[model samples]
Target: MEKARGVRTERIPLGKLEVGQVLTTTLLDEKGQVLLAKGKQITRPFLERLKARGQEYVLLEILEEVEAVAATEDVPLEVKKKTLEDLQDTLTALSQKKSASIQPLEQDVRRFVKGVRDHREVVIPIIQLKKHDDFTFTHSLNVSVIAVFLGKFLGLGEEEIRLLGLGALLHDLGKLHIPQEILQKSQPLTPEEYRIIEKHPVTALKILDEYAAIGGRIKNVAFEHHEKLDGSGYPRRLFGRDISLLAQITAVADIYEALTSDRPYRKALPLFEVVEYLMGNAGYKLDEKVVTTFVSHISPYQVGDVVRLSSGEEAVVARLNPILPFRPFVRLRIKRPDGTVVLSEEIDLSRSLILTIVGEIELQSQIQVE
Candidate 1:
């Protein structure tokens, strides 16, 4: 394997790899041949080919400093961990028809709402670094977090925000009933398969009906989040104002989270493209007020993040622009052949029409080998 300066290598079992996961380092075969380039999203076909070649393990270049800044900036790590654990326990119990208490989940929602209220700037990094096995739980957590952020931005009451958070957390509860093979299929789903997928919302309602504590607003969000403003959505195609505002908020969050996240079928779309999609669907498929509030306030990159520019240079996010979320102030980083790094003056991307952020650099800090 070709070794880069200041980087370490580790061998990982092929069986542990998941489709749609983006590796931080270059992947190499056991024979020291390059298997996949670093920073590329893994695909199902790649795994299949590796298995065909009788490869049981692959080597990865691990940057020592990457984990320090790996987690999303503002969200507390403990809250995220507890939420995931509670969500798994709650959902598992519900699916098995065993008696379960949502009190833990309720506490989780309170924490998420509090987090959203405390952080002035909220950013949902478009590239989801998640495992394929727990995607449903992770996706639900993300949606709830985003929904709470939006709820606070929209001036919702504290109790309302809590309801929205709890509802969003359980939005995809019915996916547990769906077949795993269909959910994990990398190929485009057939129409029949899609029909089955659409039934998840109905299934979720049936499961939720057992809980007396779940309010009508929360139930509405669980069932109607898939419904569009334009009468084109699934289950019961209730149009326009028939959909509650809380459900509308969850829908916006759900769509944004799903589109920005990597799926078994495709890689995650870029942040710019995802924002444009939300804008395009505003007033038609999604609520205009919710979309506008989300697009205007939610940031794609946080301060201190390293990003790649369209011109091939790298820069650090110095500040965020509230009005123009996609455009932020960035300071350029220049690396010299003599193993030194230089920081340039900050440039406001909103003012500079010539430059645009193309992608985020996964490794936040890089060290030179002496």
Candidate 2:
């Protein structure tokens, strides 16, 4: 269930809705008029009306009583906060052409990657709790965090992976050159404005060259992160062999971060939607191998997420199977009218022929088996 805080919204079947779950997003009719406003508690009559309207499922916010969702907190709060602060300082100094030694910051990023490697989350939110209007630095951190996993999954050597991590952090350094008005504009830009935007990769690369001590491969990301395999990307517009492995890796990370994070223009799309876009655009626009590897690590729902299944049953995600991220192991919550005690049980969604998670929800009561 999504909440007002850092929690993401949960999509759930209408049938599993309790009598009074609070809505997070508004419910609309086919014509787009508001059927139910956000923050309204569900009721018996409301369900009947929705049933008559042929509504199947709804997105509801997490209730107040439920524990704050924490699967995405693999990076400790202290580490995440401090890293963002450090990255901001680093980027600010670089943009201003000040002398900045980023060796310590690079080490911290590598350490964060190692933590991700050990804990192994599937589609967990990165630094979701902390809010910052200036998202560029955190966006860089997210891209690097993601790049580490993708690099490892592709079997890159440790030194290469470390370089990739550093590259991810510095990939967007050029954006600091753009005027804040253009960079943070919430509307479509004119052609002239877009041309300036296209210079970021090259600009970032040059700044890195002048200010920081970084790997040769690390600088490639600043140059080629936006280049498409088909020669459609900007700057030099080099294609195929022209794009380096680290840049290609950074490209995938860059796109995913952009799609998931809130921008000046639009709110972040759902993670599942972003994954679909990546998978759909694999070969021509993005590196097919890298995109596939990153998509494999995304879980449609996080653990501790309560969801409704296709069998008219409700369950909580017990574990995420990396091999089958969508089909996570779930603990089914069975409610029986006979008043018999229901012992808890678990199911591996990948092994079950027909069972699948359809939507996520929050129960009215935080009920659990003792």
Candidate 3:
């Protein structure tokens, strides 16, 4: 591969760009006097060929360009701390009863809660890591992180946050005894299989009850996380006030995690879409107050996410409003022909525009699916 003096291209993709390498047209100099602005990753041979043909390089910055770079390097410090704690929690929860380490487990719970309380942008990395594994144990870790983060953000005390984290982390421990075939099946489970699966929470409660330190707290969440406010849920459905606050919080966190997770039968729904689904199920299947607080912490628009606008301009979510989760600040990534992407101007949709996010783009495929 050849190099250009003025343009600096990363070696990986350019060295491998094939004969018919496709390139998107991000800019066009109709004015001819416009200064050449740098585009995001262009092939070295393409640049050389363009220069040879006396054609100018039209600068086309790619969406998530900086994010792509960051993923390959070291994860942020807070993320590292949270990750270690999550891993430790998962390992401890999965070990047999005799091997359960109490002191380290308690320390991990405290550290995890502290990490979530310290940082606002904790969900994406935690969720991303779990998505790579997506195992039952890994899912528990993700749920715990989100639960504690939401709890702290909602002004819950540190002790409550720690209890919440530990409870969420062990909420589904009964699944450890489940048959792998039933859990890993790609198709819908039969009625018999579903019945067996439904017994997991009860089994989880029994297992938690065995542990002296975490037993009572974990039992509350494990037994009642599936129980609904209307007494419609399974495992001896209890109504309203009978369910503990710990149970309600765990229930909301469980539902949110399950919806956003890629399951055996369905793909993971985007965060905004999942929020809408939960909102629609309010009062009937979920707690309205719990959902409200959960949505507030997760942020409707997350950074590095690509979304479609009302006017058909696709943009990346840049920043989010703490008070308003439905609306966020965005930077235009793709324009409608003449409308250039103004990186300098951050559009706060909560104040200026009434734009609705249609969907999010998948980072791996770069596909925008609703």
- Against the true structure, whose lDDT is highest? 1
Worst 10 residues of 1 by lDDT: 64-73
Off by over 4 Å in 3: 1-96, 120-127, 132-134, 334-344, 352-356, 362-370
Model 1 Cα lDDT, one tens digit per residue, 1-370? 1111234578989998999999777999877889899789999999999999899999987644211112234456677778888998998888777898889999989887777777655444332335457888988888888888888889999999999999998889889999998999999899999999999889988988998887788888889999998899977998999998989999998988898778888987886899899999999999999998888776777677899999999999876655456777789999999989888997777657589999898634211111
Off by over 4 Å in 1: 1-73, 122-129, 363-370
Error of 1 at 139 (Å): 0.2
Q: For candidate 2, which ten residues in a row score worst on lDDT?
A: 61-70
Q: How many clashes would you count in candidate 1? A: 0
Who wins the TM-score comparison?
1
Expressed as tens digits, the lDDT of each residue in 89-180 for candidate 2 is 88889889888878867777778777766664445443343244666777787788778777877889777888888888888899988988
Show the colliding residue pairs in model 1.
none
The global C-alpha lDDT for each of the candidates, from Candidate 1 onward, is 0.80, 0.73, 0.62
Structural similarity to truth (TM-score) of each candidate:
0.75, 0.70, 0.67
Candidate 2 similarity to native, TM-score: 0.70
For every model in order, what is the number of clashing pairs? 0, 2, 1
lDDT winner, 1 or 2 = 1
